[model samples]
Target: MVIKEITYGGLSREHLFDRLKGYPIFLNEFAEMLLFSPHFCPSPQQQSLSVAEITVGGLGLQQGGTLEEIRKQARLLGLVECPLEAAFYSRFYFTDQEEVSKKVVNQNPPGALVIYSKPLLADRNFPRGLYLRKIKGDLWLRGYRCSDDYVWSPLDAFLFQVNASSRTLE
Candidate 1:
């Protein structure tokens, strides 16, 4: 398979860290900046026209709703409740342990993250964007694409690397 390298539009690895100034930074407001700022030339370069994506946070929609839990509570009270009422509460469930719930935004202060990084996978489905989540007091970064539900990779993977002084192509 022939894959092309993807570059993040702004900042080097070290510089990105500098911008963060450390974890606990609030990044929920810059979703759009992280998405198109650098731009990715469609993973497969031939998937479809374009994919639609909603910026990560902002309304609490990202965290799903409390209807299911509330429904159960109402049902226990023997009160008549509409089944459809809880539909809006649908939460994002992950198929793998690696996936983080949108609830992270709610649980974390300032409510959301705006993180960016290099591409670890150039597969057609891999999205070229940023992700931020706070879990157990430690902040974690993720690279999640639109249309699909999965973190392409972790930001930590790029933390350490040596620069090559020259290319070996003939």
Candidate 2:
């Protein structure tokens, strides 16, 4: 597992966007909607967070599972969901192309790294999750809409909060 200490919530939405404008980022329509929504509010003070990147397979779901199932497994493994702002800051700070390439190369079936957070409702009240991907040398920060029964792929990577009690996995 790759763990990173991320500090977020000090900047406004526009400032964040301006900072990200220089990067190779592509936000889908749903992502934009979610970002600008009233539900998406950053913290008033800067907060430090520890985030871990793991795959569905790593979570012991060889066949993949629904969002609820995945969350259960994560809980069993001592992992907790991240905040919505973690996704934005994660994409903003994860600029090391080589590191991302290595992760992609290690995946049996490469896929986006979806941040495990409280799902935000998008258009039509669809639950949305933030995901990061490196495609054709360009970084993507997109929002994916999934229903309660939607099953995530085993190869899909998830970003979760690393709490103090979380067990360390090799």
Candidate 3:
């Protein structure tokens, strides 16, 4: 099942942009930061930071759960074509191309739907990670103040690079 999730990139938007010094920042770089340092993804606090579980849906593939419901949700989001195993890992979501063309012209979040129909390599033991082909014309990009904090690891960085490069390749 396709699911909607929010990923952490280990550094805030502001910190990242400050480090970039105005250089174009890509998702891969975020992944690298996660993997580069072991402390990047610290274990969840023993006590509950909040009662809410981070898992959006019960489709916990990592914890031996099913993804049928998650995929159904993605379908509800209008993703007609998607990988069969996409639910086993992670997937990115964005608007379609035509929508992107119309809405992405501005610097705000692109209206296109971009799905990274694959999982992260670090989460599982597979190489080549997941593939995020531009299934639609929507660019699926976002801009924000450089002061956001998104933590990541080196492995995360590698995955980010792989994902970003794959898009560029296509």
Candidate 4:
């Protein structure tokens, strides 16, 4: 389900501009996640945290689990589509587009959905990470960050170069 909130660069109004009661600062990022994976759900923690679980990939990455755990699971599962960068995107939820990936232009032709860990750079109106892409006839992306990092890895920086189309939006 798409989040019913106005957003720019993935940040919704409730997160960047309006501070609603009983909602965590990262809620907006989690809301956008629903747009990517149909099997995922957001579990808010007392308006302080937005945690999720990965159930569709046959992976046991659970809610409240640290970002490293998700990375480890992806590695163990050897999901080719779930690249090492999925972890980086999840860990650094709010890095700039330039910080998203070095090459940036990923599978934009097919349209990709980037998911994020947490809302990093919440103060800068930045976007979160771990957008989704389909390969092997399935959607895959991973990460769960509690804090945002500005440091962009090679694949992550390329996220900026991606030209997302409406295809992935489905």
Candidate 3 C-alpha error for residue 31, in Å: 2.4
lDDT by residue (tens digit), candidate 1, 1-170: 01112232234434443444453333333332332334422231211111111122211234332323322322333222211101101101111113344453222223223222244345545444444445554444434443324321212211111112212111
TM-scores of all candidate predictions against the true structure = 0.24, 0.84, 0.21, 0.22
Candidate 4 lDDT over 1-170, as tens digits, reads: 12111122233333422332222222235334433333332222212122232232223533323334434443454321222223323323432212123233322213333442334333333333445433333333432232322322312212221112213222
What's model 2's lDDT at 99?
Answer: 24
- Sort order, lDDT high to low: 2, 4, 1, 3
Model 4 misses residue 68 by how many Å? 1.5
Output the better candidate (2/3) by lDDT.
Answer: 2
lDDT of 3 by residue, 1-170 (tens): 22333332444434543443333323333334333334333222221110111121221223221233333333443333222122111223222223323333212222212222333333322321222222243221221211112221111101111222122223
* Evaluation by TM-score, superior candidate among 2 and 4: 2
Sort every candidate by TM-score, greatest first.
Answer: 2, 1, 4, 3
Q: What is the C-alpha lDDT of each candidate?
A: 0.28, 0.76, 0.26, 0.31
Prediction 3 TM-score vs. true: 0.21
Q: Candidate 2, overall lDDT?
A: 0.76
Clashing pairs in 2: none
